[model samples]
Target: MSSHEKHDVETSSGHDIAPATSTASNGLALKPTALERERAEQLARLPDPDAGKSPEERAEIDRKLMWKVDLWLIPWLSLLYLLSFLDRTNIGNARLAGMENDLHMFGTDYNLSLTIFFISYALFEPLTNTLLKRLTPRIFFTGIIVAWGIIMTLMGLCHNFAGLLAARFFLGIAEAGLFPGVNYYLSCWYKGSELGARSAIFFSAAALAGSFGGLLAAAISKMDKIGGVAGWQWIFIIEGLATVFVGLFCWWMVFDWPETARFLSEDDKIRLQRRIIQDRQGHAATDFDKKYIYEALKDWKTYGYMVIYMGCLCPLYAFSLFLPTIIAAIGYSGTTAQLLTVPPYAVAALATVTVGFIADRTRWRGYCNIAVVLVGIVGFSMLLGSGDPHVQYAGTFLGAFGIYPTISNSLSWASNNIEGSLKRAVAIGMIVGWGNLNGVVSSNIYISTQKPRYLTGHGVVLAYQVLFLLGGTIFMHFALKAENKKRLSGARDNMNDGLTDEQKLVRGDNRPDFIYTT
Candidate 1:
């Protein structure tokens, strides 16, 4: 049986939309404001573009627009995430460069340092994303990114374990909200059908950054003997400075939403927004209150996704934090280990794009996530079970590739299953937030005790992967059973609304039949 079941999740609870007043069918929630209603009604009254251009011509234009937005947006967002990910994980590279010798961090203390970052990172996730939504991503995100970059750079000043721990804590605090915020921001621009591919593209930057960091560390570590600073210090100084500069570039370059992007004319903004409403079957977001979060939280799918993502992300971050260490154990010098780290990330970049393409072509994310895990099973098993160093390195590719889509599909799954603006926002934020707590487990997964072989860590990874597989399977099975409530409750009658895309903006995406996606 197919493990990823999607039902007609068509309503946003606590966001009551009287469908009788709705002018759209996108299953979005209705806003109470009279001005919003007037706008929807006015848009409904406009002449249809199909009234003039042929369907083929319209599609061509749409394609061009999507390409243009994707071409510019993917690189910029990817760059931002790339720097963030690199900064977060470069400590692994730092460790390989004899930083432990300089800082005297030999024990579980190193793991504690990594774990602290996630502690701060997990606590503030929803708060950060909420700020992004409330304040607009442009101003809010740039501030956080710059703060983290500066913190990451100052890490070079650390002389001992205590100093490193403080830097790591600040780094985590500064970086906490970015991933989830980017995920939420993407939801506004891309619809369900196209989001997974773009998500993969955004993540590919992170994948490439890992590879780039390794290469960079190899070159910079060689500089350690030259300067009074250690190799690890050079990694922090160069990479941290690079991140600050890139953050400024991203501030200038990133275009947040269709409504406000400078590149889009006023008409184009409206057109893009209208198109999105059309694609979603109505308005994607209608501002609702706190009751909305409570209602969305009631769904079992929310918790199920939380568990699966937790399992998946645990191993993902573990590997990200320890790849260079793992590579060094393969008997290479620090420089060679850095070079060796590139292949796994390179493979991950390929795997992400390939899996994303396949998922989109088939419109199948659930199984695609499953497939990714299978690769992890193979990869990590080799890393743990194989005695041969050459064979163990091959496992890195599998591990990284498998973990990449866990985020992609989980977020895509949220976008697909959840309906209405407030519910969608809360659900996505919570999922991303909860999933990150898995990073806590990951931060400590590969301890100094398990070093050399890392068998215990690999064993933990396999167990978590199995847990994820079972969770994904169960979520699909019963989620559909839950969706049946809408048909039974007579909610569909209240959900019959007539809203063209423009009509939906003012009249609202009033519907009640939606259940959370399984």
Candidate 2:
């Protein structure tokens, strides 16, 4: 092959090439540009932790490091998330404990209250996530938890609808940072391939919270008329106080970043950073940049993931917030309904973690996302079409199982594909922040008048599930695959030709060397 043809072949193979002398198309000898030389040097300096280690040695090192990280990180984060979720959704339990009657909530008042929380939540998420880099996870997470916990305690003291609405709105603002913030934080520590299972383990806490919330509410409701407060008030006061304690404890427990984590040795930190850099195929810059935020906003893939997230999240919020009411309508008493919510959430927690492990092992997040969504579709279909109470109850288990896992898969997939730390942070915030607006839709659809057979709510959730399958999951899968194919075929080789090394790093996932996870 001619020299030009060889260069083409090398570029097509995704190698960086900056020849000192090369014949141009006009047969002129061209010199390497300064930027090209600089980029080449930067790539040469990129660390490889496995440089001299055997595969077995590397595996052993990884095993020990991961166990240490998981032991210190996942459980504490999961515990905090569990408390966050419990505090957020316990209002559903509160309603069953006669909060509505006590507060004199009229028709649509309760739904409006739920809608207001998500409005604040959706609005604040992106801003909060951006601040996370500045504040650090340790301070950011602890501050938000304490803020929300206080708001939740105030919620118990609400005597009227206005007080309830005020508390809920502030609660939204405070809690908005936790979910997306944790997702971004995890990306800092884990490679793209290892992120799914860890994310699943963290998120499964929401499912566990569901189970715990049900049981806690059931037992806490028995504190009726204690201190002259209603049972519903006790649920909030007790759970909220517990949350405050956990938040305060997080100050001592939460690690800021892998680099700063005191739990890891110097060698472990260096090795971990090298592994992450290698996974990105470049440096993982953490500095804040307006351009990174703009890139995330402009990227079509960010919006695509947001839509997919909404499809899953709508059903998730609807199911969690209304499960007690739905069960009560199916011949169970109020307390019994609260207790019944536990089993579905227990099953869901197990399924979520299991599927997360499978997705990581097989590296098939898209397929797993699609499969679980399909399960949820079958579940909602059963609920909509069947009149038998047994079938409808069984459907709840399927629904919980399917919906909880999809959030983990989708989050990991989005984070896996994005390359820069700040850029991924912005993208996660946008996806989760905007996606949560569906909570408004969920709150309204299950109107009290539609109690026994909430056909409208079931039907809407079912449609969103279908959209998740078709529009979000399938579209993203094919689009990412096609992009990868183009990159592999050298179509993007010249796309960054004129850019400086700094500019190219800022291009993030759009960089030709970066591959999207489908």
Candidate 3:
């Protein structure tokens, strides 16, 4: 027998099955890809712990392990994220508490402050996510949290626009890592199908932060004259100090990667790793590689997801930053406005988690995205078409519920479709980075001049929702479906016929066996 035939015989006998390669049309033997070789070695080194267990036994074990992971992992991450979001968006509440007047911020200084935060935020996200792999989640997360918390506290001391700008810029840099970093971090622990709900549970903290921030701001604003601090100053100082406390505590609470987690047993670690590997179709390398970064940059789908994220984030930031102001415009002011912001966000938090659960169970993230964006569109239209304050206030509830859920859905969709650690990290970072760059647009569009109806702001947000509906959710649904169909048809089976293993792994999501989640 020829060498190719001998290799095939070895594969059939399960001796060297890792490289699972096909012959060229010309009958030439193809070399096993690097990923295949690595996967084989990993499988040998860490055989599945559940391999000998019956299906019912494995199911029970998996259920228990998932609960353990959820109990240990999700709540801590959610708390960190909540504090991060509270620090970042509390500026909106501070504005209501007289930040603009106290700082003598002119026509666009307030907008500029918000815009500058996002500029640094957008620029640093990819960098921070890259560091997350190298530095480990514990160090990276805790360090950034401490840094941002300190900065947030100091923001309360800013006596001028320049001072506030500097604080916001640094705060942006410090807080930038948490959102995308957590997204990537969660991807490390959960399967694609499980990510939606997990991410939603994590992201619900933001909605909760909005709710809590409002109540906190309303309560804290009453401390306006205490210790010679303004209400806005108290808001920043109090919230910032609370964040610092959480950050210090996180040092003890945060776990590293699954294999290194202290809460899991040796068998649990093996089983968890095995399940994650199988979920990715066995692309399980965790080591950092330059090629993964390059591959992420080269993938068109990364940009596509970024566009979808843009649709979600633009309006998201706009609404979050301006919700208080919008409520004030709707015949409520000061504490009343702050308090009113609570219900919409509370409702949104509930809706976000609900949608996340549905997406996970249905495995239909794209469809869920469409459904939420439609709801947002209806809400935005009500705000635009009606002059009635009651109708407009009702719009906020719908807007919050609709927009908040899309992030988790779209993020899980992106995570589901992408394979590999570094590649997924970079892709998520870029998607979030580019998406958040729109905060500049979101900030400026809701100009003070466009108050009350703020037709331009409402119109722009509505347009973004439409784009999300048509260009993002609907387009990606069909596109991913077509890609999965092509893969199923086996047209791509020979695409890697002559490629090296490293090359095949670099192909990432384009690999023949990789099926996209639509």
* TM-score top scorer: 3
Residue-level lDDT tens digits of model 2 in 301-378:
898999899998899999999898888888897778899999999999999999999988876778998889888888
Clashing residue pairs for model 2: none
The local distance difference test score of model 1 is: 0.72
Per-residue lDDT for 254-326 in model 1, tens only? Answer: 7666756787666556556655544444343345455456656776666777787787678878888889888
lDDT of each: 0.72, 0.82, 0.82
Q: Considering TM-score, which of the candidate structures 1 and 2 is the better prediction for this target? A: 2
True lDDT of residue 443, candidate 3: 88
TM-score between candidate 3 and the true structure: 0.91
Off by over 4 Å in 3: 1-37, 47-52, 285-288
What is the TM-score (0 to 1) of candidate 2? 0.89
| Model 1 poorest ten-residue lDDT run | 1-10
lDDT of 2 at 82: 97
Could you tell me every candidate's TM-score relative to the true structure? 0.85, 0.89, 0.91
For candidate 3, the per-residue lDDT at 366 reads 86
